[model samples]
Target: MVARERIITTVRPLDENRIRGSFINCSKGEARRLTLPRLTEIDWSEVDFLGWRDPKAAHNAYLVTPRGGEVIGVALRAAEKHRSAVKQSMCAFCGTIHAATDVTLFAARRAGAAGRLGNTVGTYACADLACGLYLRGKRRPAVHNPVDRAPLEQRIERTLDNLARFLDEVTTDNAR
Candidate 1:
């Protein structure tokens, strides 16, 4: 097994250029034809990381390095589950609110050898996108989502940029 060090990366709000570039690059063939979701609809604050579900496989979304948008890593978002937990639950992607029972967790993995060959790992997220709600302040107890998708040239660029920001945060945190 290749020994890898866990790097603490910071999360920042994605800029317009990065978002637009990612949309352009990731949209390949039908993905391009598909109507892109509104950026405003995406809850940016609660987004722990940008991820993608593999093109060949739809089961997993892998945490990607914002730099080069490479599937260099993976992560998961889990809801704090307890019998005495809060009453209102939120979805990670859409920022919708629902009862705790209405929420489910989803898991995804990054595509390519880097992900499958053990260089990286898969992650889990809320099945209903409660994290989205937390980011947008639509719900309480902010949640996160695990996202993954096929390799896109532009997405890779966005991933690189995102990763850089995350790394910077980690470095800063370590110093503190």
Candidate 2:
């Protein structure tokens, strides 16, 4: 019997120009000014999205993912106060369990006029913004859950769904 190879849907590798052009929630100047991760150091096939925290500015994080066949980026800010590590938190994007200190509440302004008017959306996510890596088993959390027996594909789909929903919340104008 032959073993079946797993099919993975990996995000395409992006150039700095494409990444800098993908932001939907921030000004062109802001996008240009944001620090970028080392693109050359990444293995694009192992990730479903490109996410990172700004090393120069601790509170700033960014996510760039493919949506509707186009790349879109969003700028996020971490909450000033962190929850206690005694409580375990599940990352809404990847379902990875983490000590509360490893997860954070990040807020992104809405796109267009809504954002200009101060509308924002937020979610609790892995503090390092490495949900794709966590879901793929490329990285491990401090505490492990042996009971989450879902197949990798299913978990990937769920994470993608959660991400899409959050992106919609950030880009959609609910006032309409």
- Which runs in model 2 stand beyond 4 Å of their true positions? 1-9, 83-86
**Candidate 2 residue pairs in clash (backbone atoms < 3 Å):** none
Determine which window of 10 residues in candidate 1 has minimal summed lDDT.
Answer: 167-176
**lDDT (Cα, tens digit) per residue for candidate 1, span 29-101:** 4233333234466555455455434444333223433433322333332334457476555443333455555
The residue ranges of model 1 lying beyond 4 angstroms of the native Cα positions read: 2-27, 33-35, 41-43, 50-101, 105-110, 113-124, 132-138, 141-176
- Number of the top-ranking candidate, with TM-score as the measure: 2
lDDT of 2 by residue, 2-121 (tens): 222222256888999999999999999999999999999998877887999999999999999887667889999999864463678889998899878888999999998899898999
Please give the lDDT score at residue 73 for candidate 2.
93
lDDT top scorer: 2
The TM-score of predicted model 1 comes to 0.33
